[model samples]
Target: MEFHHLGVATADASGLAALFAELFDAPVAHEEEFDGMTVLFLELEPGYFELLEPHEGGAISRYLENHGPGIHHVALQTDDIEGALETARGAGVELIDDEPRPGAWGHEVAFLHPKSTGGVLVEFVSH
Candidate 1:
């Protein structure tokens, strides 16, 4: 598996992404709107950071409402997401999405329940 990206839930993605852009002096690799959210992918040396701002109501917005802006999840790249999910299930880890779903950068993604991942939301992805 490879480190993919850190997805951060924030109220102001444009502002926060801009801050990160200045801090790293790196260009935003991609920006898109989907499922009531605006997302920015800021590329780093090895991976990227995904800034999520829910324009309407979605997971990120709900996260902000409940936890108030924080690291939402860490995405790890895998060769096969479904295989990875099955591996996790075999290990007795609960899953938020039992099946892979469409994700940022056109990858297949699944979330392992935070309860099973040391209280950090862990996402498995395969592009």
Candidate 2:
């Protein structure tokens, strides 16, 4: 499982992006809008850093308001998302999305909630 991306929940998207730019000397690679989320993807050596801010009012915004900026989830790249999700389910992980869904950047992804992974959200994606 290759490290794909780290999802960061931030109240201020531009502020966090600026900080990353200053620290890593890397600019935002791309920006994508999906459903109710606005995601900023930043390239980091072998993987990526994703800054997620709620577009209007949604789960991410609520999470940020309640918990401040923090790591939201870790995404792993896989060849088969369905196989991974099935494996997770077999192991009794609490999946947020029981089925894989279309994700950002034309990938299929599924999320296992934090409750099932020691309070760490895990996402498996098939490119």
Candidate 3:
């Protein structure tokens, strides 16, 4: 697997994207809105950082309310998402989704629960 990106929950994605631009000298790589959230993707040396700003209500909103703006999850890329999910299950890791689903940039993804991962959410993706 390869590093994909780190997901960050924020109150203002665009504003944070701007800050990241100045900090990294990198422009936004991608932008999208879904599931009551706005996402801004920024390129980094290895992968990217995704800033998630919540709208009315959703996971991001709840995350912010409970933990404030901060890192949400880390995503790793694989060649086979199904195989990765099975490996996680075999290892007795709790999963948010038992099966892979479509994720950003049309990649297949599955999330591992934070409870079993040192309180850090982890996602595996395959293009």
Candidate 4:
């Protein structure tokens, strides 16, 4: 697995995207609306910063309500998502999504429960 992207939950993706573009020289690589949120991927050196802004009352909205705007999850790239999920399961990690689902950038994604991942949400993404 390799570092893929850092997911950030915010109420203002455009604002943060501008700030990050100037601060980190990370221009927007992709932008789309997916799963009730505006998803923007800012290109970094080797990875991306995925900014998520919810347009409806869903997980991201709930996250903002409870935790405010901040880092949401860390994604790791994998060639075999099923194998990675199996590894996580074998390690006793709780799975939030037992099966991989469609995610931003049209990748397959599954998340491990934060409670089982040292309180930090971890995502496995296959592009």
**RMSD in order of candidates:** 1.0, 1.3, 1.1, 0.6
Candidate 3 per-residue lDDT, tens place, 31-80, comes to 88766778788999878898998888877789899999989999998888
- For model 2, the local distance difference test gives 0.86
Per-residue lDDT over 24-103 for candidate 2, one digit per residue giving the tens place of the 0 to 100 score: 97589888887687788888987788899787887788888888889988999999888888899899988999888998
TM-scores of all predicted structures: 0.95, 0.91, 0.94, 0.98
Ranking by lDDT: 4, 1, 3, 2
Candidate number that wins on lDDT, 1 or 4: 4
lDDT of each: 0.88, 0.86, 0.87, 0.96
Q: Is candidate 1 or candidate 4 better by TM-score?
A: 4
CA deviation > 4 Å runs, candidate 4: none
Clash list (residue pairs), candidate 1: none
Question: On residues 1-127, what C-alpha lDDT tens digit does candidate 4 reach at each position?
Answer: 7999999999999999999999999999999999999999999989999999999999989999999999999999999989999999999999999989999889999999999989999999997
Q: After superposition, how far is residue 19 of candidate 2 from its true place, in Å?
A: 1.7
| lDDT (tens digit, per residue) of candidate 1 on 14-72 | 89888988998756989998678888998898888999988887778788989999899
- Candidate 3 yields a Cα-based lDDT of 0.87
Shift in Å, residue 41, candidate 2: 0.3
2 or 4, which is superior by TM-score?
A: 4
What lDDT does candidate 3 reach at residue 6? Answer: 92
Clashes of 1: 0
Candidate 2 error regions (>4 Å): none
